[model samples]
Target: MLTIIPDLPDHIFGLRASGEVTKDDLQQVLLPGLEKLSEQYKEIYYLLVLETDVRNFTAGAWVQDLIAGIKHLTEWKKMAIVTDQKAVEKFTDIFSYLSPGEAKGYKLTELPIAIGWLSHKA
Candidate 1:
């Protein structure tokens, strides 16, 4: 499931992923939200909180993710992935430079900090 995190600044987009993530979640929730944000802001500030393991994500969900990323290859300003997995967190931090914009990983406990970072773009 993919849940939208609300009450964020208009320039920031947030989502929470839990349980079995499906392509439907991406298509119905993520894609529309992203497209809406893209229209309102010049650069996207995406915050994703992962409550489930990546293994739980359906293959189609991964494909949707790749497609979305490619579509916004140069449209993001910052991205923050909040997860409890240490390996995933570390890897996201190290490989973020290759992403379109500045990307970072934070432990779940640091979600507030992540939101702050995303909003300020620093």
Candidate 2:
């Protein structure tokens, strides 16, 4: 399941996930939000909080996320992934340069700080 984190500024989009995420979740929740943000802003700051209960993403969902990122490559300004999983942290650190803008991985406990850093323009 995925739930939006409300009360953020217009340029930031936040979500918290739990359990196994499927392709439909991306289609139903993420896609619409991304489209809306694209219509309103030149760039978006995405914050994804991967809770411990969030086990993993289905293969199709993972693929969908990849496709979505590629499809909106230039629209992403910053991506902050809050996950305690070592693998996720390592992967983000390794591939951060691949992002169109900046990318950072943080522990779940540091979510607020991550948001602050991503929202910082300079």
Candidate 3:
């Protein structure tokens, strides 16, 4: 399941993912939010919180995410992922530096800090 985080300004979009995420979830929940943000802002700050309840993505879902990410690569200004998964943390730490947009990963406990950093002006 997925839920959009509330209380953020229009330019900031946040989503929390739990349990199994499928392509339909992306289509129904995330895509609409992204489209709305694209219409309202030149660039978007996206925060994704992946809790322990979030299981692995299905193959179709993973493909959709990759395509979406590539499509909006330059539209994103900042990406903050809050996850304590060791592999996820390591991957983000290693590759975020190479990404076009600023990206960072924080433990779930630091989600507020991640949100602050993503929403802050550079």
Best by lDDT: 1
Q: Cα lDDT of model 2 overall?
A: 0.83
Runs with alpha carbons beyond 4 Å of true place in candidate 1: none
TM-score of 3: 0.91
Per-candidate Cα RMSD to the true structure, in Å, reads 1.0, 1.6, 1.5
Give the Cα RMSD of candidate 2: 1.6
Candidate 3, pairs of clashing residues: none
Q: Tens digits of per-residue lDDT for model 2 on 1-122?
A: 77888987678889888888889989888888888888888677888898844447888888889888998998888888899897887777777788777788899889889989877752
Candidate 2 ranges with C-alpha deviation above 4 Å? 52-55
lDDT of 3 by residue, 49-97 (tens): 9974445677777887887788787787888888989778777777678
Clash total of candidate 2: 0
State the local distance difference test value for candidate 1. Answer: 0.90
lDDT of each: 0.90, 0.83, 0.81
Per-residue lDDT tens digits of candidate 1, residues 39-108? 8886789999999999989999999999999998889788899999988888888868788688899999
The TM-score, computed over Cα atoms with residue i paired to residue i, of candidate 2 is 0.92
